[model samples]
Target chain A: MIRIENVSFKHRATPILSDISLDIPKGGVVALIGPNGAGKSTLLSLVARLQPLQAGVISVDGLPVDTTPSRDLAKVLAILRQDTTIASRLRVRELVGFGRFPHGRGRLTQEDDAIVDAAVAQFDLTDLSDRFIETLSGGQRQRALVAMAFAQDTDYLLLDEPLNNLDMYYARALMRSLRSVADANGKTVVIVLHDINQASAHADRIVAMKSGRIIADGTPGEILTPDMLDTVFGFRMRVETIEGKPFALHQL
Target chain B: MISAVSKPSLWTGLIAGLGLAVLFVLSLAVGVSPLPLNKVLSDPEAMQLLAVSRLPRTFAAVLCGAGLAIAGLIMQTLSRNRFVEPATAGTAQSAELGILLVTLLFPAAALWVKTLVAGGAALVGTSVFLATAHRLPPQQPFLVPLFGIVYGGVIGAVATFAAWQADLLQFLSVWTNGEFSGVLRGRYELLWIAALMVAVAWIVADRLTIMALGREASIGLGIDYARMMQIGLVIVSVITALAVVIVGMIPFVGLAVPNIVSRLMGDNVRGTLGWVAAGGAGLVLACDIAGRLLRYPYEIPVGTVMGVVGGAVFLWLLFRRGGHG
Candidate 1:
């Protein structure tokens, strides 16, 4: 379980996350939904220990984020942020193999190689494996980055806006991959998503934030109402039931 | 990811290594006074010449090249800019500043003493460069190195002023223009530390490669980003200081070799480190050999040749289509 308590973060006097508390139990998909600058990404970063906890307590699997050794914490949780700017010229297989560094201390064992191959296959990146990262299209590159995080084999995966460069087709494909990974491996996937419908379709729970505070938290069916969407996004949107799932018509 | 045609395969490494070995023998032969190959078995003078000057100069050139290139690789990774290196980042100038300060205090200080102080100074200066580069927008990759060149120039200007005041201008000239004429066996042994630093880089090549993924990805991979950064700083500083101290400034080996090697072999340091080391050594040897033969019996400083050649390469890197950012 990832537990966050009264976590308040300020970036040079501008409150980014203010007194936010949330409990994310293991083994399910939880989507954090909000407008831009609503602290969804910041909260995910805190839970994954990407940033130092400034105000309160955060623990993953009962180990406090601030105190736990990063290596130990990494074994349990892995995070993939939106800014995935790679500096070096690296091949896709090599990039995915790096995800095994935490486990093997830079040397990939046979087991680690198998895991990497599995991740490469899982993301359907077999053909692109030998190509350099810079040569891939933006969506393919994002998929490669996701494949790397998946290869990490951490129980809790915190992805902040992983769907950024992906097109609609690949975006749905990625969502399905994450959903299957969570279900098959019993991994806790905490994703910050901008698409409400993607969240509605794949997410087991939707936590909505507005102004650094949680405005709504429940199953997608309970939180996708027009009134709840307005409270979180600060605008009203029409909602319709499609295949027993709430679909918000926010774009039209 | 690019599917580069040149992978660092065994044949690639063997060919590069063989080429460097040939260059090494060639360097030993093309000097002002040739040690007769036939007389070397019976001639003590030839042996003395070989032991005293030829071997030391050759080793120093190779070590200097390999070390600076490795340092440049680390610096580029740390700054996340392909163009940044010790010479441009104020590291070499800072080492000069430290050596000047030490010379003023203790004119007879040991070379090691000067080296330690210079390395420390270089560390501080490079840290400042790293911090400043971080604040600047990384999207504009050229800006970081432009800032570094300006910053290094300021430091270099100050060092020049100090040398002028102390009437140490001649000393400055010798150190600033690198050549092997002054290298006797005992004088050039300090560059071996740079050889050692290269080994250290090899041992930690994987970690350094991970750093190229940026701080967030590196940390997520269980690396302590700050510690790896510190390691990078130390490697660059020590190598820059020692190279500057031992044979003076041999520019561009660090900058050019890493860039070219990565283009050929990709940037997985485990695979590229050997090629980088070989490429660096080969470049300096080739430049040094050219310096010796350009006007036979009257040598040009290797530093001058490198500056001219490296400057041209730098411009090409900037202007070429499909060039790196």
Candidate 2:
């Protein structure tokens, strides 16, 4: 479980996350949906301790993020941030193998090797594993990055906009993989997503954020209503339930 | 072969080691006198000549080259900019300052004592440069190197003032222009400590490799990023100071060799560290030999040779189409 209490972040004078508090339970995909500048990515970054927390407390799996040894925390949780520029010379296989670093410190044991190979196969990157990351298209690179995070084999995975740069086909494949992993592996996946339908179709819970605060939190059916969508995105959208899943027709 | 891209292949080591061995032999054999290798084993005088000047000079060149290359690669990793190096970041200049002060205050000091003081100065200077460089907006990656050049100039200015005031401009040149002509059995042995620093680098090679992926990723991978950074700066500064003390300052071996090795072996430090060291040794040995041959008995300083060659290669690295700067 991940816990946050009175978490408020300020970048200089402006508040990025204002007095936000939330608890994420174990073993399911929880999709955070919001418009631009809604503090979704900031919240994820804070939980991962990418930056120092200004005024709050955050804990992952009962370990306080601020004081826990990074090595210990890394074994339990993995995060993949968006817009990271990697060194071009690293191959996809090498980047994915880096996920095993926290365990072996770069000397891969046979078990770690098998895990890396499994991650590559799971992400459909078996053919491209030897290729340098720079040669991959944007979508393929995104998949490799996500694969690296999965290779970490942590109980909790935090993905910040993992769907960015991915086309619809790869995007759906990635979501389905996340869904299966959440179900079979019992992994806790907290993902920040833009496409409400992707969240609706795949996520067990939907979290809506607006102006640096969580405005609504419930199952996808409860959070995907037209009224709640308007409050979060500041616009009304038609909601359609298909096969027990509620998806918003926001593009129209 | 493609698998070699992500990790160090055995071939890379074999090829680089072979080239270094050949260069080492050439370095030992090529000199003013005819101390033939096969004859030196039997003749006492030839062995003396080989042991006294030839062996030390060759080892110094190799150690200096390997050490500076490792230093340069670490600097680039810590700063995340390929153009930045010890020479650009005031490390060499700070060591120069340390040398000038020690010379002024204690003219009779041992070379090792000078190295210790100079290493301290270099550590401080490099730490300041890195701390400031880290705070600057990283989006404009070029700013760090530009800032380093200016920072180095500022430290160089201080050394120049002290040298001029003491009327020791000639003495200063001894620290600024690197050569092995003055190197003897005892004089250049401090560079062996650089070998130790390189060993330490090998021990932490994986940590350094992860560090190149940026701070967040390094932390995520459970590396103590801040501690590794301090260790990296210490390694770079000490090797640089040792080289400055023994052979003066050689430029661009660090900057050029690591970048070239990265192109071949990719950025995995464990895979590339040996190649970078061997490539450094080979490059410096080649230039030193060229310097010996260029002017005949007069013998150009190795630093002078490096200035011309390193500058040309640096220009090529900068303006080359495709590939990183």
Instruction: Output per-candidate TM-scores for chain A, rounded to 2 decimals.
Output: 0.98, 0.98
Compared with the true structure, what per-residue lDDT tens digits does model 1 show for residues B1-325?
Answer: 3465546578866887899999998877778888886787699988888888888999999998899899999999898888988987899999988888898889899999999999999999999999999999977888898999999999989999999999988877766677777899889888999988999999989999998888888888888899989999999999999988888888888889899887776899998898788888889999999999999889999999999999998877777624543
Residues forming the 10-long window of minimal summed lDDT in candidate 1 chain B = B1-10
Q: Which numbered prediction scores highest in DockQ against the true structure? A: 1
What is the per-residue lDDT of model 2 for residues B1-325, given as tens digits with 9 covering 90 to 100?
2443545567966876787889899989988987689898899999999999999999999999999999999999998878888987899999999988998999999878889999999999999999999898977777888899999999999999999999999877888788989999988877999999999999998888789889988888788889999999999999999988889899999889988887776887887888898888889999998988887767999999999999998887777622542
Candidate 1 matches the true fold with a TM-score of 0.98
| Superposed model 2: Cα runs more than 4 Å off | B1-12, B137-139, B321-325
- lDDT by residue (tens digit), candidate 1, A197-244: 999999999999988989899999999998999888889999999999
True contacts kept of 2: 0.56
Whole-model lDDT values for every prediction: 0.89, 0.89
Tens digits of per-residue lDDT for model 2 on A1-252? 999999999889988899988999999999999989999999998999888888999999899998998999889999999887786478888899999988887789999999999999988899998788877888888899899999999999999999999999989999999999999999999999999999999999999888899899999999999999999899899999999999899888
Q: Is the docking of candidate 1 incorrect, acceptable, medium or high quality?
A: medium
